[model samples]
Target: MRADARENYEHLLAAAHEAIAEHGAEASLRDIARRAGVGLGTLYRHFPTREALLEVLLRTRLDQLTQNAGELETGSPPGAALVSWFLQAVAFVRTYNGVVALMAAAIEDPESALHASCETVRSAGTRLLVRAQAEGTARADIDGTDLFALIGALGWVGDQPTFSPRAGRLADLVLGAILTPGEG
Candidate 1:
């Protein structure tokens, strides 16, 4: 890319990040372009779709989560690692205003722009869950899909104005249920 084109791309990403943080996954494309001081055509040229833009914006964080899972697996006990990673996953889904729904959808749709990243994060969590279950620290009935659903539920709680304050407590309750008795 040319210097000016790269600059515009960077500006669009910065603006989209801010807009998505403030407004959500549904934030207007036109508004983001306006905030970036770029035309709508330029934004489209850089990111053909909202999901495409989101995929780029969220890729780094998702990669970090994946890496964190590997580190936690080696550094922490099975139960503690699962709990820590689960909490961090919840926090990540709640970062952008309405990302919970987007992630939930993306995980289910293989063709979605965010599917690969979401799947990687889910698989990482699954590894932690499997380790914990093998150690008899976590419930054996649940699996990776269940864990991903719980993360989405907790993230959704954080998104709600009325229930947001109780998200942490709710997460604790969910974790309590997932961990075996005398564990966690």
Candidate 2:
């Protein structure tokens, strides 16, 4: 991508995250474009559909989270890494809100960008979860499937207009409890 195009793409990601965090599922693409300092045409050029844009924006956060595995491998304790990843997941759930419903449907149906992103999560997230479990920190019984289910279930909590402020603390409490004591 050209410099300007790259900037636009980054802006779109930032705008989408902010808008979704503040406005939930009701966030508008037009407003996202305006916040990005880009025209709707440019957002269209980068992401042709609102769904596509939301998918990318959500995946962008997930991708960052996926990278945490690498960073965690550097020296972070297994428990800390697991907690960090879960915290990031909660923030991601907050930003995307109810968007995972679309992703869940897409990944189950057939070939789609959603499936591609799911594969990404499976590969990296599995590794991270395994690492935590190896240390007996994460619950041995809960696998990637369970984690995904939990994240999806919790996304709705973050989507609620009244639930926003309490989400971070609630996520911490919920995820901490899910982890096997030390894992949290």
Candidate 3:
């Protein structure tokens, strides 16, 4: 990309990040363009769709989570690493309101732009889960799919206006259940 085009791309991403942070993941693209001082066409030319834009916005954070999962898997005890990474995954899903739902859908839809990102995040969690199971720290019956669904449930609870404060406690409960007697 040319210098000016690159600047516009950066600005648009910054503006969209702020807009999503303030207005949830489904924030208006037009408003994001306006905030970025760019035309709607420019935003479309760069992102093409809301999902596309969101995929880009979430890529960096998801990548970080994947890397963090790898580090934690090697640096900590199996159960401790899984718990720590599970908490981080919860926080990652809470980056924008309603993102958890989108990610959940994306994980099952191969055509979705965010599918790869979702898969990467899931794979990281799965690795931690497998490690825990192998070490007899986490329940063998509870697979990565179960853990992913649990995270989504936690995210949904956190999204609710009245029940948001209890999300953390709920996550802790889930994690506690996943761990064996001497692991948590």
Candidate 4:
């Protein structure tokens, strides 16, 4: 791509990121293009669909969470590491309005653009869960996919417009159930 075209692409991505952060995954593409001083066609040329744009916007965060899982594996006790990573996953899934729902769908739909990102997140959580289980810190019956589902559920709770303060308590409750006695 030419330097100017590359610059336009970067600008559109930046604007889309900010718009999505503020308005959520359903934020208007046209608004994003306007914010970036680009035409809607430019945004579409760079990101053919809403899911494609969302994938790019959220890819860095998904990678960060994956990297954090690796760090937590060795940096903390197994139980503590798993708990920390679970909290981060909760945050990641709740990054935007309806994101938890989007992730839930993505996990089930192989054709979804966000499916790979969801898989990466689940793999990271799975590693933490397996380590914790091996160390007798987490419940043996629960697997990574289950944990991912729970994280999405927690994120859904957090995303409620009514703003329930019970979100934290709910997280604690789920964590308590997942962890073995006297762990987490």
Candidate 5:
């Protein structure tokens, strides 16, 4: 990309991040372009679709989360690692308002722009869950898909005005149900 175009891309991403943080996944694309001081055409040239833009915005963080899972798997006990990774995943899902629904859908749709990154994150979480189950520290009935759904559910709870305050407690309760007694 040319220097000027790259600059515009960066600005658009920054603006989109702010907009999504404020107005959620449904934030207006036109408003994002206006905030970036770019034309709508420019924004489209850079990101052809809303999901495309969101995929770019979230890909780096998703990669980091996947890496964190690997590190936790090696550095901590299976149960502890799964617990820590689960908390982090929930936090990531709540980063941009109203993103939980997008992520849940993306995980199921292979054609979605966010699918690859979401899959990578899910696979990482699966490894952690499997390790914990192997150690008899997590429930055998639940699998990676269940873990992903739990993260989405917790994130959705965090997004609610009435339930946001209780998100931490809710997360603990959910995790308690997933982890075996006397485990993490």
Candidate 6:
């Protein structure tokens, strides 16, 4: 991609994240284009549909969180790393209200792009879980995928602004539940 095109795409992703975070998924693409200081045609050239744009926006954010697991593997204790990453997942769900609905909708097709995204989260969480177990700080009965599925279910709790106050506490609650007997 040309420099200007790359800049436009990044701007669009930022605008999309901001708009969706503030206005939910119902925010208009035209408005997002305006906020990004780009033309509608440019936005559409990068993303053919609203859902496709949102998928890219969210995938980008989730990918960052998943990648962070690798960075957190050092300095932070294994248990702390797992709990922190899990909490970040909660924030992602809360920051995008209908994200759970989107995720659920994609599960019907196992080979879909969303399925791969879900697996990325699961794999990242698995790294933490494996480390925690190795350190005797996480339960051996559960793996990363199970923890991720649980987080996906928890996304419903993040579906509205009214529930935002409980977000961190709820994250801690679930993380507590998943930890080894003596860990939390």
lDDT of each: 0.94, 0.74, 0.91, 0.89, 0.95, 0.81
Summarize candidate 3's per-residue lDDT along 84-183 as a digit string, tens digits. Answer: 9999989877778989889899999999998998898899999999999999999999878888998888888888889888888888888889998777
Per-candidate RMSD, Å: 1.2, 3.0, 1.0, 1.5, 1.0, 2.5
Whichever of 2 and 3 has more lDDT, that candidate is 3
lDDT tens digits by residue: candidate 1, 66-118: 99999999999999999999999999888888898889889889999999999
> Which consecutive 10 residues in model 4 have the weakest lDDT in total?
158-167
Which should have the higher lDDT, number 3 or number 5?
5
Encode model 4's per-residue lDDT on 31-144: one tens digit a residue.
999999999998899899999888887888888999999999989999999999999988776667678878889989999988998899899999999999999999999899
How far residue 43's Cα lies from its native spot in candidate 2, in Å, is: 3.5
* Total clashing pairs for each candidate: 0, 0, 0, 0, 0, 0
lDDT of 4: 0.89
Q: Summarize candidate 6's per-residue lDDT along 93-168 as a digit string, tens digits.
A: 7787677777666655575567667667778889888999899888889977688777876787777568767866
Alpha carbon deviation, residue 179, candidate 6 (Å): 1.0
The segments of candidate 3 whose C-alpha lies over 4 angstroms from its true place after superposition are: none
Better of 2 and 4 by lDDT: 4
Candidate 1 worst ten-residue window by lDDT: 93-102
* Per-model TM-score versus the true fold: 0.95, 0.77, 0.96, 0.93, 0.96, 0.82
lDDT of 6: 0.81
lDDT of 2 by residue, 1-184 (tens): 8998898899988998889877765588899999999899998999888768766766766687778767885668877876777666656765656676766676576556667776676566667778888988887888877777676666767777687677777787778766786555
- Which of candidates 1 and 6 reaches a greater TM-score? 1
Assess the local accuracy of residue 116 in candidate 2 as a C-alpha lDDT between 0 and 100: 70
lDDT of 5 at 167: 93
